[model samples]
Target: MAMRRFGVAIVLSVILMAAFAAGLSAAKRGISVGEWLSVPFSDASFAKRWGYGETNGARNVISADRAQQRNGKPTLRLDTNSGFDCWVYFPNTKDWDIDLSKAKVMRGYLRSENKNGWGGDPWIIFVDMAGRKARFDGLKQRLYDAINDWTEIVVPVGADLDAKCAEYGWKAQISPGFDWKHISCVQIHQDTDGSGYTMWYSGFEFIDYAGRTIKWWLSSINKPDLSVTYAEQVPQYKRYIASEPDPNYNIPELVGSAATEKHWPNEGEQIKYLVHIKNAGFARSKPTDFVCMIDGKVVKKASLPALAPHQVTTIVVNWKWKQGPYQFAASVDTKNKLDEITKKNNTLRFKTDAYVLVAVCEKSIVAPIEQVNNWYGSFCFEDWMRGATIDQLNSLFKRCKYDFAPNGAEVSVRLGKIFLVDELPDDGAKIGEIDKGLGLYIFDGVWHYPLRAIHEWCDLANDFDWALNHELSHQLGIIDDYQYDMGPDSNLVNHKAYDRGPGGIMGGGQVGDNVYPAYADVDIAGFNLTKGHRRGFFGEYLYCIPYKNTLVLSIDGRPLADKDIEIYQKSMYTGKIEAPPVFTGKTDAEGRFPLANRPVPKDFTTATGCTLHANPWGYPDVVGRNGLFLIRTQVDGKWYYGFIDIGRFVCEYARGHKDNAVYSVKLMPE
Candidate 1:
């Protein structure tokens, strides 16, 4: 009996190995018994669902035929005669729209009719209802390496779809609206020279991954960890800040009044407090309760849905704008409904005032004041800032983690009043200064510059709003994280790849958005009303912003006043100093060589109007080395030397700690 059982087991093992040898491994192919949505070209009705188009006047014939079917299944055939390109598309029609949110892969079988194989590359594209498209190309060699027989071509359509497509040159506009919920269309392009070729395709299907079992180890000791990450107040009202007459405000009878009235939100305005809850655990969490309180009174109570591991959801609690200040608190699973990894972060508390007053510098002693008092037309800076800049600021603070590590506070600056003022406290009347106690932002003129370079030809703009946010952050106790000086360090090896720091608004205006994380130790920080005035927090300049630097040159305690200095930098490729100077300029009366506010050199400008400042620092096309420039000046037939390294953000070696740093050297006769 034992011998007979062993013989049967051997026969079963042989059959299983034989099946695997015939390419029947489900795990290898990511295939499972499931609901598969397919586009089988079994009949002529497929032509109705699919449309064909040509580019470069290409001639092509596409049809469904049973003659060249794969495994007795009808196949779609494409014959290319004479053109640069041709394509077949499943249009964005009502009948073809598919919900691919749960899908894992879109795969098909393809074969070439010619013995030597086809000469063109094949590509597939998926378009969402929002008109956003994701295209994947270079499949000629990838999918059909040797395709006299049917070859399998797989493209991931799940969460990793974009990443999979990106491996093979994906071209797509990524928008928040471009999601998998409604995939409207699918396209296949044949990119070839006007050569005659034929190809057949069959078994195009979308495989789902939802029902697939994910193997995860479970331990009785492990528990779900739920935490309230952060919270913020979102005001739901319209405000405008404009320095020009309202062009769209037309009330024919009250046109005069409409133009002058700054649209500020009034009392009793609706505001939503958003609480972010995260399941920061290895296991999924059960459905739980969320509670929100305002000034110790329960304002909202709602049930939260069950959350997967690491999933986060924001619960919104509505409130009306009341007079004075209010304290806010939120908690998840308040009743200890489920065991969690930790309960320390399950609740959060913060405070904010009902409204904040913003005083504008209408009359500046430094610059001319432009004001239009009449209702017919007026330069309304208040409305313009309220409408655009403040909204942008609030959006940034909603994501800001200030005064705390990891989970920062989100505070809102609700505009209470917009009044003109001639002066601000503590010299805040100076341009770019802001008094947080008074919400006063001193504006001199248009503040505009390139915050960062998106590419060689394009730069991201940092205008009035950027300067405002940076200054406002200072008032909120956020200290400048940028190094402000250039001190000598014998051991400091300035390399482009080595110089890296935490980049954000505090780090010398290196970011495009104000939502970058920052830290502050002052008592009154973020958008909170728990305030006691702390002096010397605002109006301070960053030690070094990107592309700008200031250096004081002196010798033997005497300034190198009005002297010509040459700037020479080492070649990144050769590691040798270039003979001809990159820039030569005269020092100021105080021997200050201010490299700030200097425009890109004409030599660095291309005919295409792109700046050659594409390297990490503002230097031209240096490959590896940091932008270290040597300042050389001749005095009494002797040369004095000093160095400044500009590589992305300033390194620890270059940090001099002084706002105005000095570099002094005595020229020696050799």
Candidate 2:
């Protein structure tokens, strides 16, 4: 799902502490005026319940004491003039520490100062003690379409919220181990256009459907005899067992895996996916068999335990994986064992990893190819190349087999078609471009350079070979990691989130000879193979310099120009400096400071400490803080700073390879 449709623009970053207290009891079986777990912003003191959260850039929020009168009611206000994003968090205060295990929905009221002035939907996040969060798109709740007055916002919590997360493609934001009982904090994030605007929020609460409203009472009484709803309510269970891509790919389950390191599933490995079955009916469900099928043949059938109303259970189905095309389907009650309402959702189809390649070249270039028959084979000379070319193409493509799996399992890449054309299409097609199914154009020189002038076909063959594999990767739906067309800037080549590691076909590896897809590249290709073309960031960052080796400073996505920078080692949690300035220097014309080959300290102590893993697969599935540092820079008479996680960058991304441990710091001005 496109996040823009939901209007959520903020990327939340905050570390919350733990909290626990007795919660209100659920009202017994009736829709009555029950006590609501709520935090009211009716007065300025509401600020005491909330704290300032993290932001990517400079943004500000006024203190709660500055509460303004809106619609004659005291409402808390936030202002953004920094042209950047920011957020505020409620850290599960003792007074508002309502247990969310029994909560059904989260409701609130919000208003904007100017009509239709909202930039995007605000995000409401629930973070548990373990840092696993349940983040939701607040657009639906905030009533974004019409936001003149105080609009009532409704957000489903628990299982209901999980379904909503899946529907909106927000499953990636949720970390594993998130539980309703351990909710430690709540954060509301917003976007800005640089032009200042005011947003007010009030009356935030978590309520239950069974105990709260008259609507719950009416629905209970008006039930149509036997109603049943079975579905994959959790986002984590919706797809094949693959790691979700990032707004922050640093999540441990993704980067800290063999799938990213050694690229597993070489010969024998198990392909796994989670199957969630929910009983959303009023009555309990009798035990039935859960059937799993591959290619329309039942492969696994297991007994399912009876489930109470609103209860959800997950079944793990796995098979020995091989490189090829496959179709997976699962059903809850294949034999119609449960006599209830409709069973339309009992079966579901899963995505598969399979691809075919088509190679084509122009006819005009064929004659020049025949003359060099001694050096090049006949298949390379023919107008519609055959024989040797097919075998070679298949070999090159099959090399991508290991990387093609989404998470080291389920993959296929086969050569499909080959042909020659009199003239390539001039529909804005660049040199070495491949259409989705249509074969790619194979010519050496630019459009202006005619094929008649090309005499040495064998010499151009190497470049053509590289282009062939590189373009084929694009046809499979992977994107280039490096940036282009930006003139005279050293930092223009890389992105801020460069964590995919160094050389790979999609990145720096293209400059070398034998090109193959990176582990990250293949993961993306596999995702597109099954998930279709959903909007997302795949290979998010360009390979920059090694961590702390060279500091490339940029502000507002532009090079900061010549400036002075200070570096220091600091505690990860508290910003307390553990050491004085390690190095101080002025940036060059491109805002780059060469650190004289100084490496970041590997033994520095971090807030969360560190764990050593022999290989990527052995790494724990939790993010840790090891070697964290502070970088302070001065640009245009103002100071800016940001933290760099050298320990994590090395452990997860670098993995002892300096070239793979690249990083660039972007500081926020004070």
Candidate 3:
């Protein structure tokens, strides 16, 4: 949002701060109304009462002879000889009469016009009854520069007024004995020696004033609303999770007992974590199962079947041991068994190492080629070839090693039809034939074609090398100076000097000397892809199954064909029980490992629900469903499956090597 500027007025009571009992009493009295005097400048009768000065260049001249209409409103034309040097006064003012010591805020409306005014020149002043004056220099006033319409000018009489006056040479004029009483007069003036000037003024007022005190406050129309709002009102499927494991076991230790430093065990590892989940569906969600895994192996899992509609939940998970470089993931299952909705409801992937460490990196960039084409298509080339010979044309092509049929294949030149020729030979072709082949004409030895032909021909890699480099230069908004005769029968050999000296390409005839396109630093930056720093995978393999509710792991989307997935099961809240039934099976040709009903202890109620984990060598770990009444496994350690709340199913793929596998899983409400 752009910043907006606003003006405010504040009123303060000096009597209350004076430390006098009587002063406090005076402050409680509030503001008092002053007299309103009308100074008529329109009626002919009032004009006659005051003697009028010179009708042409007098200051504050009241004329009854020249009144007119402006913008359908009655207006008085006040012409002044000197800039802002106009004032009106009472007929007889020999002594001060009105009191001003109890006045505060003053504001007014003004309109002015200058035939040759540069905008910031001085033009007005205000004077009090004591001969004290406040000068308003247009250059010093902070008025809006874009103000071509009528506007109100406000002047506060409190601390700001005193401060601004001192800073701009107005304080010295109001020193000791400066009596502000009887100062109910206004004046408008201008630079003494400027050109002719005219101005319009009207609508004046004084607001929020109590003797000498002023109060500042914002206008009722300019207040803003402050309220809380959601970052995104609509639900989404994205989820984010952060985790850390104890140093002793590491992230890799959660895969299985046989897990090496590079491939840790899935059981007995501890991890700490948090998860943020967003649901994109409109329907309210019920309790669901959640699971976490490291390197295609399940380390932790949980289940919650009561997530509300469009609600976001953050959950914390703690593991028992340290794990190294692994990916932490979570998901929600609408069904207790492996199915599509379960797979779509929950999932977030992140590198364990990235969470534990911070690093600086760069973004990617690309080039702009369209800008260069428009610049070169504005010139005519026909006149330059008006008197060229066939030999000269062939020689020019030979000099550039321009192959017309190097691969025994004829180049397709669309210019033949436009030039009214049937065909042209590859070499030793007549000048007219050459022109026809190029979709252009060669009168004598110079060749000429429509600008579109250059655009079409330049797109071809073999012939466009130099043409495009030259045309692209023009596209950069640069002008071309290559001269060509617009008239017929011009000499083909006689060329104009382009003045683009030395290695110049387009402008100068030395096209081959500098045949590369010119680019700014921004252009160069677009091609800098090396900044991303690619890393190589170390013995890592990926297994992905697109079907929902099915736990099938594969390498590059290919099932591990006959390879077994190992399964592990335990309580997420407390690790005090023996492993459940061992479920291991090999995958089909599609790399899918399917596991049906496994065993869940009948003795453990909701107080002792269990999670299932699966893992395959070289691939990451996978977690089955959580809060399960039964556990299942397939393809050995490669795939794991389980159910939550007895009906909701969930699964996960483990990631990370053995040495640094850390997994922290959280059980969140739907």
Candidate 4:
């Protein structure tokens, strides 16, 4: 029976060896397995039986174990004298050459166990003998909880890795082809607190990582092949794919004021219109291939190096009409349709009807002073009118006549009394008055008053030119040089010299005192013109008017008592409607009421005109009775109010009124 059992065992052994040989023969060709480094620990054995120590080199030293008894376990126990410290050498004793060019990812598993080393964090270092030492610093510290267990860590070999390696003092000479040949040392460390720690480690492997490519293959069996390569294609021919739509591309919408069919500009006049192009989208729009066309003829093209999304660009385009009243449109190419079916890639369009009248260059003529008053007082009036050439004003009227006309009917002004008898107090009430009008208030007591008074009294015409020009500019939507005082001694010279630099309109006349105007002041005036209304008046009332057809007083569009409305009517019945009718009325609660219904007496009608007057109660200083005559007029089919000779009224009243004493006036027609 023993001989028969021995025979069966021999036969089974031979069969097993034969099967292994056949499996080896069928294996694919590759580098054969050789002596590779073995992991130092398998389970918990390293911490249970081994004793540890430390070396003077700051390395953890493990007491040597008997080679035969310990097997392949780490024979050296790391020392814990100064808390935790340990090191392991990945000896270069085998033919374990890694083909870095073919490897996709490098990975390993590591841990430590010394009780002290286990609690504190430790890092595993990979060193290359053929190159320099590369430190993957803080990598282990980040995985605090991940250290205890056998944790797998991987690193991809790409430009990012190359850049990182170079940044960390690694020798730059090593190219991407360099191999990770050796791990010179592995160590464990503890925090300054000296808490003991221990850990164990095992598995290490290199994975053939193929990220999205593998994911795609796994997701779809019929995925398109990505092996084909292409070179040199024009932008038009190439599939233009933008991560986002061009910001400059705008969808059609109403901006600023609503457009009305009747108010549209004439086709020829609309040829050149300014419109703002804003980037209302989320991405930048490159304007490399943009072109602007009018009536199918190219007028302007833009190459906006880059128009960031949400940024605004102002454009002036010609709106030409090809013999019809059809609307003109602006378009932009989004360059995005091929990749995704989206409206963003399509050309965006904005359309508006052409103008109604053709623009012609007409010679500049001085705007009638009356027309100037009306234009300045209108709520819709622009600051440009203060310095506009007559031609420009006419052109503006011709272009926006309808809009401007209605706004003119609502024109009004706020007047404050300036006392020349005594020094002005800087009380809140005076401050409030100045604040309301943002105008100058001159008193006669300042040391420089004599010089200022000479300019005011002798240069009446010049005063009209400078004072009226400056003050009216304020009423006309121009800004003040708030930096100047409204004292009696103030003159153009004082204004200019006060600042000791270049004098502006607010600086008075001395510094840049070329009687006409300073270049900076003129530039400011021009800017005010071009920019429309002043920035300061955005929320404030442009003008105040008595309600139409109501014989009541009004202030800032609100009704007040009759006493609050002051009227001044000119003497002449020139029959010239273009002139601002000499009419001024204060308001009462019910609304502004006509102060007089009768015509001016023949005696009061001077070579120029008749006069009318009215004044608010409580503001006795602003007496209305001093004026010579009252006049009546019709506007928009309603009886309007006016004061005939405001210049003469102011002059006479300034001379007669006592200092600090208030006076009142009323205009009753005969």
Among the numbered candidates, top TM-score falls to 2
Give lDDT per model, in order. 0.45, 0.42, 0.29, 0.27
Q: Estimate each model's TM-score.
A: 0.27, 0.29, 0.21, 0.20
- Between 2 and 4, whose lDDT is larger? 2
The residue ranges of model 4 lying beyond 4 angstroms of the native Cα positions read 1-85, 92-95, 108-122, 139-143, 146-152, 155-196, 210-670
The sequence of per-residue lDDT tens digits that candidate 2 reaches over residues 5-53 is 0111122122212232112123332221122322342233344334433
Model 3, C-alpha of 227: deviation from truth (Å):
72
User: How many clashes show up in model 2?
Assistant: 2
How far out, in Å, is residue 554 in model 3?
Answer: 99
Ranking by TM-score: 2, 1, 3, 4
Better of 1 and 4 by lDDT: 1
lDDT against true structure, model 2: 0.42
lDDT of 4 by residue, 1-670 (tens): 0000000111111112245443442342122221121233222222221212222212223333333122354333333334323333322111123333333444544443333323333343433434333334333442355444444445443235565444432222333434554322222223323544333333333334452111000000011111000011011011111121223321111223221112222334434544334333223444533455545556666543345533545455554433332333333432321111111212222222211111111112111111111111110011112222222222222222111132211121111111122322345685445333422211101011122222122112101224433443343333333222222233211111112135434332122323323312322322222231111121011011111113433333444454333333211222112223334554444544543333311111111111221231111111111212233433234443322322222222323321122212222221
Against the true structure, candidate 4 reaches a TM-score of 0.20
Error of 1 at 341 (Å): 27
